[model samples]
Target: MALASIPTKQYIEQREEGYWIKGSRVSLDSVVYSFLEGETPEVIAQNFPLLSLEQVYGAITFYLANREFVNTYLQNGEAEFGQLQKDCQQRSPQLYQLLMAGQARLSQAS
Candidate 1:
């Protein structure tokens, strides 16, 4: 049997910042992370609720064409998130402990 080809979608115009993800009103960096997490264009569109399917596909295409840039963005986002988590933990020990325990359980299960 022959494999089916995915349909090509039109590119969405980006905002003046040039870092806008086609599908989401959010920054390109955010969309890159979402895509890296294995989210589908449809899922991204649903999450944003403001972007069209064409925009989502366009964002994916843009990311694919600029893998290096997007990878850097993802790395920076991870670092930022880690810092935020550390700050939260420092500010709230009890909450941090609870969250840490939950994460430990989740890691063990996985």
Candidate 2:
């Protein structure tokens, strides 16, 4: 008897904004970050209800398979986010301070 072969699905795709899970709007970075932060695949799936357990496993597998490329991409994204935050703070210091204060208040309340 021959074992049946199952075709693989493309779990990740690169869009103009960034890498996202195929067929969903969730970003691969979000899943990867949560995984790196020690969240189990089961927890990650629960956190992202849009993604199935299989998809979470597949995304993690993709990250492991292309670790180098994904790491570079994530680093670049972090740099970009940092630069953007700096620009925003510089562009409107008062507004930035206000937003920061509001965030602090929310954190304290939580």
Candidate 3:
């Protein structure tokens, strides 16, 4: 007898950007990161109350099943986020410079 194939339904959803859990805006990365940080599934669910424990387990299963691909996708996403932050800072240089100046002042006061 053949084992049943995995169905992504009720567990994961593919968006334009990437995979997110069904019925919640939480990304699979949040789950994976928390898991990597040694957080339990229950704690992950608490960290993202919108996700149930079962969903957390399911996401972990998916990640385990496709660890390499998922890791690459996570890396690419981090790179993209870094680029976006660079673009935003470039677009609003003055705001960030002023914010940096305030932070420097606070650090000196401490």
| Whole-structure CA lDDT of model 3 | 0.91
Screening candidate 2 with a backbone cut-off below 3 angstroms (N, C-alpha, C), the clashing residue pairs are none
Write candidate 3's Cα lDDT for 4-106 as tens digits: 9986455888898799998889999999999999999999989998998999999998999999999999999999988986887799999878877899999
> Superposing all C-alpha atoms, what RMSD in Å does each candidate have to the true structure?
8.0, 1.5, 4.6
**What TM-score goes with each of the models?**
0.59, 0.90, 0.77
Give the range where candidate 2 is weakest over 10 consecutive residues by summed lDDT: 8-17
For 26-101, candidate 1 gives per-residue lDDT tens digits of 6766666788899988898898777776777777888899789767866876888899999998999899999999
Clashes of each: 0, 0, 0
Best by lDDT: 2
State each model's CA lDDT, in order: 0.76, 0.95, 0.91
Clashing pairs in 1: none
Residue 67 shift from truth in candidate 2, angstroms: 1.2
Candidate with more favorable, higher lDDT: 2 or 3: 2
Q: After superposition, how far is residue 109 of candidate 1 from its true place, in Å?
A: 13
Model 3 residue 54 lDDT? 94
